[model samples]
Target chain A: MNHVSDHDADHDSVYDGLLGGDDSQWAFGTDFEDPLAGVDTTLPEGVDGAALAAYCLMLGDDALVLSHRLSEWCSNAPDLEEDIALANVALDLLGQARLLLARAAAADPSVVPVLPEGSPVPREDALAFFRDQDAFRNVRLVEGDRGDFAVTTVRLLVASTWRLALMQRLVTSRDAVLAAIAAKAVKELAYHRDHAARWVVTLGRGTEESRRRTEAALATVWPLRWELDRTHEVERTLAADGVAVDPADVAAEVDVLLDQVLAAAGLEVPDVKRTGGLGGRTGRDGVHTEALGKVLAEMQSVARAHPAGRW
Target chain B: MSAVATVRTGYADPRAVAARVTDPEMPMLTLADLGVLRDVEVEGPGRVVVTITPTYSGCPAMATMRDDLVHALTDAGWSDVEVRVRLHPAWSTDWISDEGRQALREHGISPPGAAPHRDGPVPLNLMPTRRALTCPRCASPAVEVVSEFGPTACKASYRCTACLEPFEHVKEI
Candidate 1:
């Protein structure tokens, strides 16, 4: 891959070229090489490694699950460019999830879900592909269905907006790994927020059909958003210890950003009543919707088929 | 995350040879030219650690950059080479050197202008603004964005009205 032409970075074409050149670079699977290859991952004094692991799981799960949802649009987005956009966003989240999951697995291998006897997989893959829906710790905002383009755009706008706000503060975390991930992620999340915001405004102010659909999408997606803002006990504990961010604190800024986007899009913020929500079973508490189980069935199918497979 | 932070040995960094590695996607631009090269340092005459940041979180070129750095250093006879990626003071398009920006324009990619400060309260690109992008092909401010993303993740697709040529616009992060 040289600076030969415009084709070097084409997502699919890279695989096409690599397929012909190097057997080592099969171009089929992720580069599972350790992301924190040479960095010091030691926890600060008195900061519980287990607690930090849990916090990392909470953050990692959000990114992993949302990345899966976003990737669902790969070939189905309204246009070619949009398909690329969604995939780029998904890959960014996947990259973040990869690093954080590796961190979690490093801090507490005990939390890694069990797999078959002789099956070997990276910790991040094990966490993403082996866990049951009940074992996931991502918030509900990222676990549900990826709706129509309008709904997805609105959801992306909301999800990235909230994440950006949270990441801004996380960049200053006491944990170096968490801080680095946050520092890296906030930039990517900022683009996701803005990209979605553009579509949101375009749809919100487009033809009558577009306006109606955008409003309907907002109605469906806005209620689940509250689940993301509520602080889970694990996050709350880590927040107190300066190891994690409290979701509650990010809400005010998130609200302000959401309002700004909504206003610019000429859409009213929905007053959708929060459903049973994260009540007895919040996502951080390992509670997720049935949709997640179905999603995992599909996402993990290939790995489950050949447990020891290395692509 | 590896429990042990092992720095690979048998590498060299004479003249900062790795800094000359070009971005794999945009071959015309070196990583140093793009401001992706943050620092190159030698430790005790035995170790050379090169710190580089990715232009985007998902930029595919990062892996290529790292591998290129290691290979280049190994060829230069350094005993130990360490490449550390520091995410703090995150990489921004604003960091592109003046020379790099000039290189981008000369190579047919419009260099990004100043973006909203990360320190600013508002997140970037949320508001709709249709600033006429200056065209690299014709040096005209009459270019219109055709797509938010381009052939590469770091750029966007646009066409210049003056030259009527489609080109890449380096997105302001």
Candidate 2:
């Protein structure tokens, strides 16, 4: 009945790496390099620092909020494999978020709040956890509640497709940091979009129940799609500086990609009308949906409780 | 201290030491084999700096890789070690060394095929990526993907029809 082998008896514990005495190094800590290290972070000519930082916030917040939504599906996915897949996608977006947030803080350190002396929190962590809901700049498409699995997949398909298009153009940004981040992001978002597209097709072509649910999910998510294409003032300003992509420019490409995916799945594009904000003040203008408040509360609670906390 | 004395006290080749540090997730492959250890330099007497690139933007193993590089160089008698990450000219699976591919194969994992070449936007392909690979265990060409994602960000799960064995494939980026 003995399961222990000779090798096992040689060690007093099995979790050598986890239980090691090295308490200084933790995941997502200061061990990794600065995402912008060695890169020329100088501002481009005639580009306002505030505008550039706001643009980064817009993209970074979108990733951070959607990543949080995806992470909520950690153990709740339909199956183990899918659970892992969603987690992987979430982790990728989180990584992108960290870099983007760091870039934002670097571009405009004033946007980051002043914390207690010797606080271990990096500016990126501060931005992610300390911002008020009214300060967040994420589009509503990403901040909505995680609907059913099918709905989530549809959202992912649309979000990643649009992001990939934006990132593709962002690779040529006048800002080196944005260009580097975009170069890395384009590859990751493509994979994410592909994963979502495949699932959409599978579910759409599955049993009648699955197809019906997939279509319903698309209908629920389609109206929010227009907000992704609306160009905000910060984006418009940065675009003029050659440091940002006008989402409006990429809207057509996103539509074509989405249409292709829907056509493959034998599903029609939902004829839902585009939703709007109150007097043109959208998420980019610090006006977010109620869902964003709930997401930010949960995401920022732990960090706010102990601004100096490190694990 | 004399120049000769300083040379005697200095550590062995930092690159050699760094190249031997295995990936924390894929222990079978060293950082060099994984194509992440981009450069290793002896900055001064005991200070060594290592450079690496992540296979994916959100790779969880990156921090671990950095820590391992520092630990390995320290253990090899270097007093000061630093790791830097580069994102430009983003990492590609094509950089995986031949020996790295062999190691993955021996570990029952399929090595990645050539990376996709892009002149413009990355085209969307709903169909499964067609990879020319064989089962690492049985060398069977009849293999199908079980899941597009594996336990790690850079891998995918596959099943060999001939041997009926599930395996992981290091997906091309």
Candidate 3:
């Protein structure tokens, strides 16, 4: 992705068109730098900036990739309002990804410090140039696959519930940035969970045909739950420091919610069966499905093609 | 009277001026009515800084609102304006003031009463059940959710049996 200088005059025109008139020109930045720059970062004492950054990247990448998948359903949704709703949800997740990734980049010592005097690089540039999948920290649920609306809703229910739990815990993090982001994200994730749960129940109880599909979708996505609860050394450290939620603590809550949802829909929860155990936590390790590559390619395509083109 | 004093303009206070900006999602409520416009400071000459936070981090309407705010203030002749987005002590449904709540009730949308039982860390033993919604129109607690998702992401469709009317209930986040 090419970086555009804040000084370009044409940038203003295009932005105005997108935003409608010159009314909001003040809300955006002319500096063309990452928005997270130089805002008094306070990391927990003794925590490793690089590791923290990598951890954040894991979560951010999960949101980014899943958001991309959700966007594919934009105009193709079953109804017009639903199309708008899905797109809105996707954009919400995208906004979360942008903030998380920008925070990760800011936390990295290797990346230039985001200070008033320092040149802060745009998040797009950092995302484009930074580490690959091996360094990502997202769980398998977000990166696995986007099957159908049923599958997506199942995944969304589980992921959003778990994230809401995590975000609730994160609101009290010793690390201010994490806490602030969590504070902002908790309500949004709550809505997300409710939205997904509604769909899961609707489809599960709607018709025999729909119920079968919903159950199958739940079964297909169940295995990924293991990845969601797995914790690594960095996670453990952060958990100890109150900067991250213990994935284990959230597992029970997530299960109870899922079980209730499934029961309400009259679908039986399938017994857990392990598969493809060799990836060693694919998401946290940055060893993702080919789906991620395809997603990144499309996401970065426009910015890459335009380079520094205005708007 | 002198020609310079020919016209007398009514001057409205800043609070009254700021109250004219409404929430994009909840058209029935203004920013002041919703407690979103936390602070408005007129500093320096014609420069105004409005501090606002989003109801949620990814609310799509925020971008539109920031534009609306600038337009409202600028068109009112406060051109050197700055809009600051703050995320700390993040927005809560609790922030909706009593006035805002009353406005919502008057607008035929039920306001959030208390935090939902599903909002806690531990799952409630109760079955996933819908609570009795209070009718915004009649203040009668005989409402049922007709649909889980409503007209917008923040609302749920409801039918008030007492009033024999269909209305939207602002879902508690």
Q: Model 3 in CAPRI terms: which quality?
A: acceptable
Interface RMSD for candidate number 1? 3.1
What lDDT tens digits, residue by residue, belong to model 1 across residues B1-173?
33222332334344458768878888887788888888888764456788887677667677777777766776687657777876666788888888888888899988887865647545456554465568887788887887777777787778898989999888877
Q: For model 1 chain A, where is the 10-residue window of minimal lDDT?
A: A22-31
What does fnat come to for each candidate? Answer: 0.34, 0.60, 0.32
Q: What is the DockQ score of candidate 2, to 2 decimals?
A: 0.52
Candidate 3 residues lying further than 4 Å off, grouped into runs, are: A1-40, A78-85, A109-136, A198-206, A263-268, A271-281, A309-311, B1-19, B41-48, B72-80, B102-110, B116-143, B159-167
TM-score of chain A of 3: 0.83
Q: Compared with the true structure, what per-residue lDDT tens digits does model 1 show for residues A1-311?
A: 36555454455354566445443243222434456676678887678888888889888888888889999999999998899889888888888888898889888788887776766677778888887788788887787889889888888888889888888899879888789888878767877888998899899889999999999998988878888888877788889988888999989998888888789889999978875645567777887788888789999999877767543
Q: Which ten residues in a row have the lowest lDDT in candidate 3 chain A?
A: A112-121
**Model 3: per-residue lDDT, tens digit, A1-311?**
13455555447455456645453455442335333433456677887787777767766777777777777887787776566666667766777777778777767856422222332446535574344555555676776567888888888888888888888888787878778888777767766787788788889889998888887888888877787788877788888877777788888878888888888778888786844445565567766666666666766666554444433
Residue-level lDDT of model 3, residues B1-173, one tens digit each, is 75322321222345556778888778778887666787887665566777777665556566666677767877776657676766676766777778888888888788875654434563422233377668877878887766544556566567888988999777665
Residue A206, model 3: Cα distance from true site in angstroms: 5.1
- Candidate 2 TM-score over all chains jointly: 0.92
Give the better candidate number (1 or 2) by DockQ.
2
* Regions of model 1 farther than 4 Å from truth: A1-31, A114-120, A277-279, A309-311, B1-15, B39-48, B78-82, B123-132
Q: Clashing pairs in model 3?
A: A58-A137, A58-A138, A133-A286, A134-A286
lDDT of each: 0.79, 0.87, 0.69
- What is the CA-based DockQ of model 3? 0.27
